[model samples]
Each structure stands twice: as structure tokens, then as C-alpha cells.
Target: MNHPIGEQTVLITGAGRGLGAAIATAFAREGARVAINYRHSRNHAEALAASIGPQAAVYQADVSDAQAVQELVARVADELGPPTTLVHNALANFRFNGEARKHLDTLQWSDVAAQGEVAVGGLINALRALDEHFTTHQGGRVITVGTNLFHNPVVPYHDYTAAKAALMAMTRTAARELGPRGVTVNMVAGGLLRTTDASAATPEAVFDLIASQTPLGHVTTPEELADAVLFFASPWARAVTGQTLIVDGGLVCD
Candidate 1:
């Protein structure tokens, strides 16, 4: 029930850049073997794996694809001894541009469906793929990346927000079912990060506006949020499951 992070092999999705890379780095720093999964950021992922040393590896898989995830899980198991922690961070990584974001009228079910395929469906595929590994190993950990937009919809990231809402629900519900199976599921929610692939397109004024409103007086960095994710993977959080720990700069309280 208490797996020290140093002994865990963490598989992080969409880990080529941005917050996912930070999360991968944090786990590697803790001496955990890391499988950095990326859909498109191949170069970044490869560089990250090299920087993390031999304990880290690069994997290419679109989490929404069931077959790809299955192959991904199998490869990780063959290479890293069955992932003890699965970090479902393969987010839409939705851009934060207000003008480019989806509005109520402009948002379509396709947009929502696309996000859902990754947000919810990806988790399902990963869990299913990891089922045997967790069972044979006796237990495992599942840490999902979430956003704080559900509490405070500061911008109109309509479809993205909707998908995360459902993901959060699944996180808790999965915990209920998986807890009995010795699997712990939880979420780490962060607000608009200071710098990430997603936030790079955000206007400087918007960043400044958000920072001013935050209690921490600064935007949260990817590393900061990534560290919070490590908490859930570490032994300290063994008894905690189906919970959401918002790692923003206290921008929104849950």
C-alpha cells in the first residue's frame, strides 16, 4: 500500500513539453523510473529522456487510441518493469487565448467529443491496459491532471472545461471501484500556469491580470504543479484517494 516514489516507475502522458515535462522531471528527480509518453513532441521527449538518464524513456502513443495505449503499456512493462504509477497528463493542453477559445455558441459536440476522447477515454484505456499489472503487483497509483476552471471559469475554454469536469467525476468514481482492488486514484488541478505550451499563446496582459488576482501574487509554474503531483505518487499520500488537490497559486478555492 505504501510504494515509495523512488521504487515506482511513473508513466506520464503528453510529456514532451509543458507541464507534462515538468511532471516527468519531478518524478525522475525523486529517483522514479519515468516513461515519457508523447503524441507529437518527439524531439522534446527524446531530449527529456536523455536528460533524465537511463531511468527515463520516450514513448509515442495517442492515449485516446486503445490499441496504442495497450502497446504503450506493454512496452513500458517490458522496459521499465510494469509502471507502478500512471500519470494521465495527456491533456488537450488547450491554448489559453481568449479570442481563439471556444464560445458557447461556437462550441460543437465534436470539440467536446475530441476532448472527451482524451480526457475520459484515455484514462479508461490506460486503466484497462494497466489492470493486469496492478493486479499482479497487488496495487498501483493513478494521478490525473486537471484544471481549476470548473470552480472559476475565468475564460471560455468551453469544451476543454467540460471534458475535465467529467474526468474529475471519473477520478472519484474510479477510486470507489478501484480502491477495493488496491488501486488509488486522485487528481492534481492547477490554474493557468505561468509558462507551458498551452499558456505560451496567452496574452501577457492576461497573465499579469491573473497573477494580480492570485493570493500567491504570481502565476504557478509547471515545476510547482509538478511537485504537487509527486505528492500523490509518494508514500505520504497512500491513504488519500479520489481527491483533488488544486495546485494553483490559490487562485480558486474548492
Candidate 2:
């Protein structure tokens, strides 16, 4: 199957800001029609769509909600045609301050379940919503944003890491099931992104420390990681699926 990035319609959840916004921009730059999905941050998402010109549009939806996701897909199809590529980047609200995080002893199952609802559950919703589109289009691409914490839990963001681990497993399983349909599912994991909304709480010193450990000598930026997402959606990655490409400057190798 030939899935060219330039000819695709890409739907990105939580694209109002941060990494999701960057991913939206990257696809728009590649000539694909972009649907920026946001549960909140309408201003940010709308502003982003404006910046991306007519090729991009904003849609509001809580990806973790099944009905909302169904409506989101229908609205995107009515407004921007069916999205041939899905980027599951929506995350439940979270902060990066390790000091503020609940320790293992204090962490509750609800905390983990909250993250899972958005990470794993959101993916499930997006896939189900796009199933028909993929069937009609003959092929599709699914990219789930993940974290390097799964590989090296240096900071031990227990809930976030656990949810992402489950997402990765689901990604692989979906890839296997979707392969015959010409739909490829994969993951793009990054470490300590230079500065996204979620990482705003992280101290500058931590960035410096992580950079020092990375072979590239710098923490990865959201834009840099977003490029890897384009690669997965591009025809170049037609034969690749069920894989996780870590974009943490060689900090963790899988």
C-alpha cells in the first residue's frame, strides 16, 4: 500500500498545543489536510489552524469518550474529508514536576486509570472511529505518541509510564490486526521534550542534565519529534508497523 504523507488527511487529537500542535503543523507543511482535535484549548487550536492556512481545521472532542470520538470522525469527514492518518496525541492533564507526583506508595489506581483512559482508551476510540474510513480508503496510518520512560524510568512517572506501556502494547496488537488492511500502526516515543505544556513544571536544570546524558547532547524538541511522526505516515514507512522509534537523542536504545 502506498501511503504518501502529502496526499493524506491527518487527524491529530489534543492538537491545540504542545507536541500535538507541532504534529499538526508538520503534516500541514507536508501538504496533507490536517484536523486539529482538541477537548479544550479552542483558542490555541483555532489559532494553530489559522497559522496552517486552509489545509487545516479545528475540531473539539474528548478522545477518551466513545460518542465524542464518533462525532469527531463524522465532523472531520464532513468538513475535511475522511482522515487517512490518525495521530493519538491526546493526554489527560499532567504535570512534569517529579516532586509533585505521587510516590508509588501514595499513587492510586484511579490515577493510573485516568492516564489509561486517555492514552489507551483514546487510541481505541480513534481506531474504532476510523475503521470505516480505512476500509473505504484502502489504507491508513496510526501513530501514537509515547514516552521514553517505558525504556528508562529515570524519573519514575508511575502513572504516565504505565499508561504509555499499555498504549505501546495495544499499538503492536493493533498493528498486527490492521496490517492486512494496509493500515500501519506504530509509536513515536521521546524523552524530556525541550518544553511542552506538560513539561512546563520541569526545572531547567533537569533539561541540562538530560541533554548531558543524551548522545546528541541536547534534549529533543517537540518539532524534532514531530518529524518522526511524518516519517511513519509517509510512503517511506509503508512496510513498517508495530514499532516504536525513540526520538530521545540516543538516550535509550530498544
Candidate 3:
């Protein structure tokens, strides 16, 4: 177990289901007090918190709303203590099925902007809300979830991939800006996960195909990717920042 992670409070955005839920579970398993942030998945969030026992609690906030995020921080601080580790995993409405995806010909800037609102814009909001707490505490961690499509362009998910790429840029930039305050900002980019809410619409054949092409001979799961995310928050990565760890079963060598 990492030194301080097991003793700190963690805030995981969009943790009602999917990849976010996996992250929350990972934190709790590490003995971190988990604050599960969800926008619309109340039932799922409550259920998850319950299953995690007393170490977890659920909060609702649209990460894109600055005011909401501020309020969220206050609530979590009151209930779970000010979060020393933040996982900005909130994603806009998206499905990972390539067949049902928008192609470059039919894609629109608005589609891309919507994702940016959540990916980049939401990150700004979360950071703004947590910056003071982070600097004051002097040892906070910011972990953003990203995608591996930037290198492979497997399905050409124009909007989703573009937004995540922008997120990676922001991740690095934030690392530089926040590093002096004794904080580390990093990203975990995972390939098409074997099963998550966002990837549920993907065709079975696509999963099978990806598995066959991977060096590990299997598709990555949300839990597997979540474990890599844990690494960035752990003491082992104390000297690391401004980087992306790709967890896709070696499908893309990035």
C-alpha cells in the first residue's frame, strides 16, 4: 500500500458507474476514504457507497458547473474531509461503439466542444475548487482519465479522441503549474475497456478483435486500468508528474 494514499480522502468524479466506479472501488480497497461524485446516477452511486461500507459516500455535482463543483467540495469536506486526491473522471454522454460513432464527414465542432466542456472545462472547474485546499495541504494529487485512441485511431472516434487529447495536454500543463505546490498531476489513458458503461455499446466482435491484436491476448478491463491510476497516486510515483500511462494490454505501444 502507498504511504499516504491509504490515509487520505479521495474524490472521484462521475463515480456512479463504469470506469469511475472502478476507480472509487480501488481507492476504498486501498483504505482511502472515497467520495463518489455523480451527476445523474444517484441510485448507482448510493448503491456503490453502500457496498463500499463506511469508507465511501456519494455526492452529486456536474463537474462542468463551477458553482456546483464548489458546493461539491464543501460537502465532501464536511462529510469526508477535504479531498487530498482528486480523480477527474467525469465524462460527457458517450458510447464507445465504433459502428454507431460519428465519422469525420458527419462530425461537428459542437460535438467536440461538448466533450471539451466535460473533459477540459470540467477539469478547470475541479482544479479551481481544489487548488486552495491542495496548496494549503501541500501534497495533493490530480489524476485525469484519458483514452488511448490518440495513437492508434482504431475507430476514429473523432470527437471523443480529440477531447481526450486536449485533456492530455491540460494534464501536462497543470502538472507544471501545480508541481511547485507539492502536487502531482498525471493521466491514465486506457484503450477500449472490455466492459464499462461507456463501452457497453461496442460490438462483441470488436472486443474480440482487439483482444486478438493485443500482446497480452485480452482486452483491458476498467479494474485493470484503475490499478494503473492508483500507481500515480502512490508513493512509488512521488517523483513523477506530467505524464500519461497507457493501459491497453499493449495494443498501442504508446
Candidate 4:
């Protein structure tokens, strides 16, 4: 098996379940010590850490809270050493209770703003915290998760799409600012995966449509998307920054 990215520690936000959990597990399987950050789902986080053994530990932090994030990083450093790779995947949990989907008019602007704010704002805080560490460590990686909707925009995922678009923009700007310091920032945008908690609320027809459009003739999976992230975090992508790798099974070909 290939070795882990480094002897480095990685902090993965929203690692309690779904794609986040998969990413955390992938990193652990590769031998990286992991700090699984979760807003809720403490039980799930604990279980995942257990499966990954002593190299993995769970930390609670609402990425949206600056103070909480600061403390979370501090605690992780105190335990596992300073994280050299940061994955921002935390988001407000989706409710898949078959609630009626809100229309553009019914969806409040505040709701949309909150989504972008939480994701983008949390990124800013993470970068700021990582900057100090990177200054001494010389380099690190910051990988953000985005969605293919920013390019397609036909799915009517208004809040989610808009938030991801903003994230890509922030990613580009951050890369420009951090690149000079040996830090790299990038985004891995994936199309709708078939089996993530977030996609559970999506109707079957929607999945069928996506599957039909993808050139690969099937929907992507959480682990498939995680592969693109692993690429960004690896040394192979050292020269890549401020870019978005769209892993949508060729659905949204640029």
C-alpha cells in the first residue's frame, strides 16, 4: 500500500458522516493521523475513530464558530500535532424528511447567505489559523469541497449552488495570497454522488437525470469524489493551486 501523505496530521471538518466520513477514513487508511471534526453526530465520529485505531481522534467544533474553530485546532495540535492538511467539509446537516422543497420565492435570502457564510467564513478562519503554522512549517495544503452546480446551475439547488460558487471564488483568491508562502489552496467539485446523506433528500428522478448525463453511465460515489480530494492533498498536486477539479463523470465538461 502507498504511504500516507506525510507524517503529518490532518483535520477534516464534518467528518462524522457521508463524504466527510469517507475522506477521513481514506486519510486514515493511508496512515495519516486524523482529527475528525464534527458539529454533531458525536457517536458516529467516535465509531469512525475507533475503526481507524489510535491514529485517529474525534474533535467537536462548529466550523462556523471562529472561537470554536480556534480552540478545536489548538486541541488537535495539543494531541496529534499541528495539522498540515485541512479539509473543510462541514455544512449544516440536510433534512431529508421529505419536506416540501422551497421555491425561489419561498427560500429566504438569509438562508442562502447563511450557507455561503458558514462555508466561506469557516474557510477564512481555518486559513488564518493555518497561516501561522505554515509560516514556520514552510508549507501545507487546504482543500475545500465544492459542487458541480456552480457550473451547471440547472438543478435549482439555489442555496447550495450559490454557496459553492462563492467558495470557488474564495479558493482562487486564497491561493493567490497563500501561494507565495508555500501553501496551496484548491477545490474539488463533484457532481451529485448516488449515496451520500446530502443526496438522500434528492428524488429518484433527479438521480436518474444526473446518471443519464454523466458520460460514465452511472452516478459518482462518495469515495470516487474523495479520490479527487486525495489528489489535491498529495505531493503530485504540489504545483496545482487556485483550481477546481470537476469530477462529475464528464457531466459538466468545461
Pairs clashing within candidate 1: none
Q: Candidate 4: how large is its RMSD?
A: 2.4
Reference-based lDDT, each prediction: 0.92, 0.94, 0.91, 0.84
Q: How do all the candidates rank in terms of TM-score, highest first?
A: 2, 1, 3, 4
| Candidate 1, 1-254: lDDT as tens digits | 57899999889988999999999999999899999999989999999999999999999999999999999999999998888899999986567888788778777899999999999999999999999989987889999999999989988688989999999999999999999888899999999998988889999998999899999899999999999999998888989999999988888999
| Every model's TM-score | 0.98, 0.99, 0.98, 0.94
Error of 2 at 8 (Å): 0.6
Mind giving the per-residue lDDT tens digits that candidate 2 earns over 29-87?
A: 88999999999899999999999999999999998899999999999999999889999
Model 4 per-residue lDDT tens digits across residues 11-30: 99899999999999888877
Candidate 2 whole-model C-alpha lDDT, 0 to 1: 0.94
Q: Report the number of the highest-TM-score candidate.
A: 2
Quote the positional error of residue 66 for candidate 3 in Å. 0.5
After superposing candidate 4 on the true structure, give the runs of residues whose Cα lies further than 4 Å from its correct spot. 1-4, 95-99
Show where candidate 1 strays beyond 4 Å: none
Candidate 1 local distance difference test against the native: 0.92
